[model samples]
Target: MKLVQKWTVFMLGLLVVSFGIVLTIRAELGVAPWDVFHIGLSNQFSFTVGRAGQVTGFVIILLSFVVGKIKPTLGTIANILLIGFMIDLLMLVVSSPTNLIIRYFYLILGTVIFGFGAGLYISAHCGTGPRDSLMMALDKNLSYDISIIRGGIEVGALSIGYILGGPVGIGTILIALGIGPIVGLSLNKVNQLKNKLQPKIDCYN
Candidate 1:
């Protein structure tokens, strides 16, 4: 039952994250750095954004394993497969808001939702997502602060994405600045909740 519950929460978190990604795209305001890279691939390669993400994620997972010796977990595999599919499915129905204000609203809301979703899944302790795994791998090998590694990766992604003609705007800036703090806060809160519940969950066993 605990295993079932954990996976349920993990899947739910991915679903929410996918919806958040689609919302950001629909806003047309720009997207997170890695997402910018995915969108760039979609534009250049004639793939859907979600398909592009899946391909990119697969490559990253491979690299993480090969170079970083990071084994893929079940959660990581699910993340690679499911988030992209969910994003594609949601994008079909979620329309762009024409109003500038509403677009900004979508941008912010999407970022927050994405953060919380990330927090929920991460706190489940199943595994880190592909990109995050890659970051951890890099941190292990390079011995750089995780923040520096993450920032470097995002900057690199953003640069390539911009060159590939992905959308770049204020929303990109907002996501870069806001997502960390939001995810941090959400993760802290979710972990706290989980800690509180764990004893009761264990009592059942």
Candidate 2:
């Protein structure tokens, strides 16, 4: 890829995160499971989720590093900024949904957008997001199946969110279930894209 195109992809990743933020606030159904926890923490402690995400990412990245995992890279930076950007977008422009239907639709939108963004940035082979990091940690430490482990993560996070004063409703449950399929679809596309790019990169080398 040309320098210009690579730069474009990087910038697009940021936009995708910003878009996710808007969808989240507009969804107003409450944040997705992990985000619900972050938001709840933020609300209770008077910190924004984005800032919390960054701090969480820093800790997770350090832990992963200590484990001899992938070193930090631009995707790591993106993960940090993405949530921060979302928080800023939330504070600046987006508003809560007015009704249940709109709220649900907003969550669906947020899921798709967030999944797509995560797919793209993750495909960069840089680093996983903070939430993804937490999920992987659970999967590793508990030696559980991905589905079961992820389910536990969501259930645990949502419960924490509930305790922390985040909204929990049908949407919370829906998002927990819905995010997996949507993200799987998005990541499949990203994997295909990565496969297609590999030969070109290999050729250049």
Candidate 3:
């Protein structure tokens, strides 16, 4: 894998991630926990979800710097801008289905897609997005399992988002409980596939 390949994977992963996020919004059952926070900010501040996400990304990036003493990578910067824009763009064209069965389908599909996208970005190894960076930093500093740290982050975000009037439903709880394991599973599968396809060089390159 070359630098260009890494970048392409990173960008594609973000696009896929954003599309999945939009799908969840369209599902209308609820959203992922961090997204619940973003929606809350959007509602309270009179901004779009993308705008709120970008602002939150900036804040999280700064926190990552403070905690990890690392500068944002090009991948990180791209993740912040690209996912935000993609979500807004997708929202313009997509809408929620009225049927209950269809809505639940979208929710499950979106969560799975989001998990796979996250795995792809992590496999790219260019860098992590701001929120993920913060989570990783905390995991390192606190010597906790990634799963535990992720759950804690979700709980914190959910609590704050709820307080700030973010929408919550069964889907939120589903995402909160399932995302970590899904992401880990996806990561393993992706790495295995990458290794089988290109055994000579590091997939991250």
Which candidate has the top score in TM-score? 1
- Residue 74 lDDT (model 3): 82
lDDT score at residue 58, model 2, on the 0-100 scale: 80
Candidate 2 Cα outliers beyond 4 Å, as residue runs? 1-7, 63-74, 135-142, 190-205
TM-score of each: 0.93, 0.75, 0.89
lDDT of 3 by residue, 87-194 (tens): 999999989899999999999999988988888888888877787888877876887889888779878988898888887998997887777888999889978888
Q: Mind giving the per-residue lDDT tens digits that candidate 2 earns over 1-205?
A: 5545544555565578557756865677666766777777788886776776666668766775655454666666676776586666566676776888877777778767876775665445555665566566555666678888667866887788779877666656665676667667876886776678767752111
Tell me the lDDT of model 1 at 175: 87
- Taking the tens digit of each residue's C-alpha lDDT, what string does model 1 give over 1-205? 8788888778888998898888888899999998999999898997998899999999998999888899999888899899999998998999999999999899989999988888877767777889898998898899788999988988999999999989988889998898889889988997777778777772111
What's model 1's lDDT at 167? 91
Best-performing candidate as measured by lDDT: 1
Better of 2 and 3 by lDDT: 3
The better candidate by TM-score, 2 or 3, is 3
What's every prediction's RMSD, in angstroms? 2.0, 3.8, 2.4
